[model samples]
Target: MKVKDGIIGLLIGDALGVPVEFERREYLKEHPVSDMMGYGTYNMPPGTWSDDTSMTIATMASIINKKSIDYNDIISEFCEWYENDAYCQYGLFDIGNTTQLALINYINGNPALECGPDDERSNGNGSLMRILPLAYIKDIDYETVENVSALTHGHKRSKISCVLYIEIAKSMIENDNLDIDGHIKIACDKIINYYKDDKELIHFKRIFENDLDDIDKISSKGYVISTFESVIYCLKNTDSYKDAVLSAVNLGRDTDTVAAICGGLAGIYYGFDSIPIDWIDTIPKIDKVLSLCEKYEAFCDEY
Candidate 1:
């Protein structure tokens, strides 16, 4: 259950999808991505990743350096990366609209938690994408996950999505054989139980519904529900790490993010050994990624 296994696996997915980000599904069907590619959308090299990995790494560094879930540190790190191009290869080329707005609020001296918009439309996959690290954070609470998600997205749907996703990740990391559908059902039930008193369950109707029957509803859109369903769909349908992530990439439009999110789950379920060594080698700054993985492993043990 090495955290970096998921992180690097996610980066591979991000790198693979970066090139073909807005290509339609029909276009991708005709021109399938068989391997990690580059220089199409962002025109970067083969191993370069987008804001997904950068923000995920920022969240990881905040946990490691601060030894806790420090929202201030997380926002500061994100600003550093956004302003100075830190913690990424070839600099920050892309960012989500909600994230950009939240960072702007941070730059204007608003508190990190207050930065994100609270509207329903603010429900992009921005927070959900980088939340895998928090699943490995020691003694993390669902409130902490909510707070983390709120740093960039203040909607309840976004918070619930993070909480559920992290719970699923925790389940996979701790128990290899946990049935995906059953585990997800349990996780969703718990979410419903926990939040039942606070808000109507209708807002998160998608999370409560059976996703297998709603496979047609899944997509690579930037919406949190779409990403959440799409990731789970790819994981359920594919057996190997390669197949899971490639399935995500083929969804097209927001390809990098969908694949990255799916790759994170697959990496945990399949173990680091499941990831292709050639894919691992092709990623830029492989040594650095491995170093982070080691630190994350120790972090998990200590706390």
Candidate 2:
């Protein structure tokens, strides 16, 4: 299944980035990551992933177990993973601030849809990092993407970025041969046209106009916009799936997230087989991932 490519590719990217998450690009210039070695940032053994994969798998489990994309079930799954450590090997190790607060809001009796902070400052990459499942979902729209994002981050910029990401992922699934630059242009134009009246929509216009080949000011941070731009930059600049994910990891801070997010796109465009088999074996709990992929494929078939 292409969803396997998207999810497992993302998990592999997350695992690859875990050991060197906070190291700067300049430092990585000296000691670059050649494989999925561990014991750097989080001090875990090799193959240990962070909240990026944890939440992603949680969401996937939610979709499969609930037999639908019910936001409440998804939120509950996130909570179960956060509090009960479901699907994660080492429990929750790296949750974003906004996600923590939003989970708290949910635990404190806030409506699942109303739990997230709507403040502009709350725009974060937490929700965006684990939103790949929606790409495989049937009959999804920008509003559904926003509501899902609203379970953690409620800002328009974040919601819009998620929509654009899902658009690219879905488009990639439909036409694997589509040119990446052209695909991005279509997604950007479609999103910009939909949200043109909003002044904030101008923030993503560069993605519409530029192909990221000449951009010298890329930031690899956890903020939603930076994460979105960084993922795009990595995808557009790299030639292969390996290079695309490596480019994201070497960009530094928030490495797992940046790579995981970019990996979904690279996986979709490059195909699942393009991901290195050695790297795939290096991930822990491969059986679980395989089972989830099977479940997702069967669910899609039935849907």
Model 1 C-alpha lDDT per residue in residues 40-99, reported as the tens digit of each score: 988898888889999998887887898777899999999999999998887889999999
**Measured by C-alpha RMSD in angstroms, how accurate is candidate 1?**
1.5
**RMSD, each candidate, Å?**
1.5, 1.3
What would the per-residue lDDT of candidate 2 be over residues 207-289, giving only the tens digit for each residue?
A: 77684565458778788888888898988888899999998998888899999999988988898899999888877798888
Top of the candidates by TM-score: 2
Q: List clashing residue pairs in candidate 2.
A: none
Regions more than 4 Å wrong, model 1: 197-200
- lDDT (CA) per prediction: 0.85, 0.85
Give the C-alpha miss distance for residue 20 in model 2, angstroms: 1.0
lDDT measured at residue 13 in model 2 versus the true structure, 0 to 100 = 89
The 10-residue segment of model 2 with minimum total lDDT is: 207-216
Clash counts for all predictions: 0, 0
